[model samples]
Each structure stands twice: as C-alpha cells, then as structure tokens.
Target: MAQGQSDPSCRRSPPPGGRSLRQRYSGDHLQRILLVRGLLKLLLVVAVLAGATAAGWQPATAWWAARNRPKFDTLAAEQGDVIEVINSTGTIEPVQSVQVGAFVSGPIVGLHADFNGEVKEGDLLAEIDPRTYRAVVARDKAALAARRAELERGAARLQQARREEDRSNALAERNVASISESDLDQAHFTRVGMEAEIVMAEAAIEQAEANLDTSEANLGYTKILAPVAGIIIDRKVELGQTLAAQFQTPELFVIAPDMRREMRIFASVDEADIGQIRLAQESGKSVQFSVDAYPGEVFEGKIAQIRLASTTTQNVVTYPVVLSTPNPELKLLPGMTAEISFQVDRRDGVIKVPNAALRFYPVRDHVREADRVILDGTALEADDQARGESPSASAKAEAEGERKRRHVWVVEADGLLRGIPVTSGIGDHRATEIVSGDVEPGQRLVVGVAPKDD
Candidate 1:
C-alpha cells in the first residue's frame, strides 16, 4: 500500500442516499467552524478592553485635568489701614478778593501800583489828571464870592427901604405933609420887597457854596486809593488810560487779600455725594487735595461752606463746596486746578485682602464641590443641589436679611484651594476689610487666575 493512499476503512463509500461520507464532511464545512471560533475570540478580547477603559476613565481624566489646570495668582491678607475716599475736582482761589475801580473819571497821570505789587489799605494806587476838576473848583469859588457881594448890596438896599418907611409913617402922624405924599412914600418903600431880595441873595450864596464843596470833593477823588491790604494780581489801567464813569464802573485792579496767609478751594460735589459731606466750617472733618503745579504734595483743608443752590451743566447737577487751607509759603496760586478727596471712613489694624480676591471666580474644572464654605446665608442652596441636599427653611428665611456674604480662597497645605466666607465691613478700590473670617494676617489668598501665555 502506498503512503499517500488512505485505508479502505478510512475512505468512506457513497451512502445509500447518493452522497459520499467524505463529501458530507468536506474542508469548506470545517473552515466555516474555524471562522466562527475566531470571531468569538475577537469579541471576547474587545469586551475585556472595554471593561479596562471603563474602570480607569475617571482617574485618568482627573489626572489630566490636574496637569492642565491654570495656576492662580495670590495675595496675602495684610494688616493696614483702609480709607474710603470720595473724589472730586476743584479750583484754588483766594479766601478774599476785591476789584478796585475808579470812582471818578479822568485821564490817568500817575501809576503808583503795578501787577504783583503789594499794597496796604488807603495806599495810593494811581493818580488821575486833576486839571478839569481843579478848574471847576476855581469857577465855583469865584461864583460863591460874587454871590456874597450881591448879598451885601442887597442888605444895604434893605436898610435904606426900612428908613424910608419909618419917615413916611412919622410924616403921616405929624399931619404936616399931604396924605397923598405919605401914601406914595410908603408904597415906594415896601418892606416885603426888600426882605424878598435879601432872601434870594442868601439862597444864591448857599447854592454856590454847595457847588464849590462838590468840586473840591471831586478833585480829592482824582487820587485813587487801595480799599484793602492785598497783593495786586491784575492791573488793568495804563498811565495814559482815560476812565469814564458814565456807565458801569470799569475794574482797574484785582487784589487778592493776604495771598501768603490762606487759600480757598471751590469744589463741585455731585448732587448724589453732597449728603456725604459734613458741615466742617466749625471744626468738622478735614479734606486733602493736590494740585497739578506741585505733584505728589498733599495739602489739607476744612469745609468752609456748602452752598445749597445746585448748578446744572449738561443735565448733571452739582453743588459748590468751599474748603479753606493755610498757604503760608504762598506756594498755591489762584485759579490752579486741584484734585480733592474726602475721607468718608477708615479702618486700621484689620485683616484686609485685595479687591481681586473678593471678585475672583475659579474655572469650572477647578471648583471642588467638597471645599465650598457658605457663611451667613442659604443662597448656596442651589449649589448644594449637586450634592443631593437642600437648605433648611430657617436658613432660607435668614438669607433674606443677611448682610452681604463675600468669600475668598486660601491655599491649603496639600496645594488645593479652600473657600473662606467672610463678613466685610469697609472697602476701597484696592482693598477690603475683613471683619469676621477664618483668615488671619499673613495668610496667602488667591486673588486671580494666572493669565495664559500667548
């Protein structure tokens, strides 16, 4: 028997149904069974891989998030003063100012004072030409003298009239002269006419004297005098300038009273902030200000007056607040712009944090639900819902009346952020006072998330 030939027992003959046994169990049927087994093994391997991935998805994602998170910028709570200030702008002016003007009109002949000249009260500031006034005075004096002479002449005539009347009356009584001659003499020597002429002459003399006195006063007025002791900030008249008093009095000099002694600031406080200003004229709160002329140099003053009348510009209403300060060195000038601030409140030796800390919010991935601390309100109940809990009814009621609740984050020893809710008292733009909180001085606080690199 050949090696390749099969035994007669192994080689099956055709069956009675006309199909051989070898054909019934062919290679194609075995190949189909092997393929089905291979498919089952591949499905089992895929199921194992899916199970492994499901078991590690959470930790893998957590690790990735930890590595890719943004680092935060931090600030430490400090112990210092926090002052709340109300800001405003104003102009510096002298406490007292006067405008010197000419009372009499004449051509200016002499200038005794110039710009920036110091003067005292009753000091001669300028002189006007007195020729016209002097001429009027001379004319009035001559007229007065002429009127006095007229009075003397009238007095002599009155005396003659009186003597004549007496003689006529005596003649009538004696009966030595005719009655018609006596009557004619009495009519010619009427006493009322002589007395009337004397009165008229006296009236003319009085009028002439009054006119002369007026002319003398006008001549005296030609010398202009300083009304107040001050420094002349402005001189408007020239040596040859002619002033006219027919209309309004033209200003010749502007004097600032005691420029080296004191100064005043007129600040325009908004209507909304006027209520915050206290009456400080009689030793109330003090205010601080700075001028552009002297940078970084602060000057202090007190409120002198708060005008009740409001001024409206572009529909914005403001009130004038007067502040006075001493300027002994004369460093401040009139009309210089000053930036002012009123300290409304201040706190010292309190734990304070940057305003950025109070306003900082972490990204969604960085928020840890287990680390939230709600201090003084039930407003966090919505946030608690994620933890499968709801706030109590008492907490909800208390939240309605609770003072504002603010929070800041502190870094833990394990390099994780934890929130600390605090009771805030006072605040400014840069810092806020922490009245009650778990934080203390010298603690690092998360102010803001670090900016990303470009």
Candidate 2:
C-alpha cells in the first residue's frame, strides 16, 4: 500500500474500538426514553402517596377523637324525702282591722291615744272641742225647766176652774145662788179650756226633754271612743286638727284588732296551682313561710280562707289566700313580705334520684345502637312499651298514658352506657321520688359530661 493510503477491504468502515453512529444514536434515544419512563413512575408514586395521605387523614383523626372522649359527671340515687311544694309571695297583716272616724264636725283638742297604743272597748282615743255643744245642752236644759214650770202653773189653774165649776153647779141645783144657768155653763167650759191648756203644757215639756236629750248626745260625741279592743295602728287626727263630717265621716284612726296575738298572711296563688292549694286546705295542711325581716326564722301557719274573688294583672289571674299564724313574740309585723311554701305531696324514705340525671341528654354514639332509636324521637305505642312487648320496657305510667316514657344513662362494667327507665311520683327542685323502676339506693347514675380541657 502507498503512504497514507490503505487497501479498501482492510480500511475501517467504522472506527476501531468505537460503535457506529446509528448505534450511538439508538443508545442515546433509548437512554432518553428510560429517563422519561423513570420520571413518569416517580410522578405516579407521588400521586399515589398524596391520595393515600388524603384518604387516611380523616379516618385517623376520627379514630383519635373517638379515643379521646369527654369525661362524664355522675350522681348516686339516694333515699330521702321528696316534697312537692307550691311557692308564693305573701304580705303579713292583721286578721281584722277597724277604722275609727269622726261622727261630728269639730276641731280635735286632746289626743288620748298614740300610735301603737292599745285601747279597750269604749276607751277614749281623742277629744274634740265641746264648747259649742255644751252651750246647746244648757239651752235645752233651760227650755225643759221652763216647760215644767208652765205645766205646774196650768195644772193649778185647771184645779181652780174645776172647784169653781163644782160650786156653781151645786148652787144652781140647790136654787140658793143668784147666778144664771149661763154662768154655770161658762164655769164648766172654763174648766175644760184649762184642762186643754194643761195638756198642751205637758206636751211642750216632753218636747223640751227630747231636745235636751239630743243636745246631750251631741255633747257626748265630742269625746271620741274606741269601739273595739285593739292597737292603734294609725293616728290620723292630731291636736288642733279640724275634721269636717258634712258629707262622709272622716277617718280619725285605724286600729288592728288582736294584732299581738295573731297575724295573717295574704298570698296571691296562681290559678294553675289553685286546685292543689284547695285540696291541701281541705286536708288542713300546714304552711311554712319565711320573711325578709327575719331571715333565719321560719313561721308556720294554717290556711284560713280562699277567696272566690280573683284578681287579674297583666293577663295573669290569681286568687287570694289567707293564712293565719300566731304572733305571740310579735316578730312578724304588718307589711312584711313573706315567702310561703305549700307542700302538696310528700314522700318519705323513698328511692330518689337527682333531677340533673333525668335532664341529661347524651349523643347517639354514647348510647347503645338499639336505644339510639329512642333519642331519634321514634314514637312507640304506649301500651306496647308499658307491657314490655319489646325487649326494652318503660315505666308502668306509660301504659295509663298519664306520664311519658323516659330513660336515664348509667355506665356499664365494660365502659359502655346502659339506660334505665323509671316512673317519677313526687319531686322537688333538686330531687325526685322514683315510683317504679329498677333503681336502688347508692346506684350511680350519669348526670352530664365534663368539659374538655382547652
């Protein structure tokens, strides 16, 4: 071979120890495809991871929340007294009150009684000006004395006329006197006239005596007296006070009779509770009350009367009830406000439960699946529920339709919730008596859930 020249067959069609261009190009394209496929697989893996995270987050959170549930508060059933009471506000006052008034128009001159002073029947309370009445009485007495004198004089004249008439008649009959028959008739007529004059004088005397009596009564009216034995609660008339009694009698004083011995409480009971109060009154049930003035003390009273007259205020009707209480210590005063309680029913040594337990309502998850229907407000037949036709039964009252079926929650041994049905009879604000149920004393019942920590 010549220099820088090679034979055609021995020459390298492709460079020695190097691949062909086609093969290099093919290898580069294959590497590119493999990189793209690897990138696609990484993207698919990321999408799958995102989907799994999104799908698992909610369930995981729910499981954690269920694990960390709220704590519950509980109360135990106990044996105690359950009293149903009717509360009312009342005012203390006297049992009977009387108003003393002025009968005659006069100026008050003397005050014999003061406020809160005790007075007996016919006791002097005040005195009015008696000068004008005294003068009228004297005038009437003088007129009566003059009438009596006139009556005596007329009687003497009548007797004289009668004697003259007798003498004239005798003389005429004997025919010895020189008098005419006409003179004898005149004497008889004079006697008759004198007798009429005597009668007129006697009538005048009686009239004067009546006038004197009227004047004396007027004089006695000047001294004011008490008609009943009581304490003077109010003294309206003071010294030098003028009272005019022309149209209506002006009230001078107000008296409360027997106030120290007894006091009455006037309470307004709601119409809704009137039936219960009436029944209690018929049974002679006692009432308990407390006053703001005497905070720690309680006063007992009995129902005295229930007035038929009802008073309506703001579209609410109420009846007045009068309660009588002894006030020997005089601690209760008039116008004091009393907080009264009327016990309609009472249960002693009965299985009682807290009212909070009955009022508690739980979420669906806390209760069993079967009982969850109860919380859903699914109506069940009263008869079937009371007869225990279903596996779960309600109280006996549910059968009679007198009461509604109710359930209370109790914690089971496996940390699950169980329901108990009970019939309630009498109840107070805090507790209630269980009439019929599977409850017993010292049984713990769930009342409410405690708040979660912040």
Best by TM-score: 2
Prediction-by-prediction clash tally: 0, 0
lDDT at residue 421 of model 2 (Cα atoms): 82
Model 1, span 200-252: residue lDDT tens: 99999999999999999989888888999999989999999999976878788
TM-score of structure candidate 1: 0.76
TM-score of each: 0.76, 0.78
Task: Show the colliding residue pairs in model 2.
Answer: none
Quick one: best lDDT, which candidate? 2
Give Cα distance to truth, residue 362, candidate 2, Å: 4.0
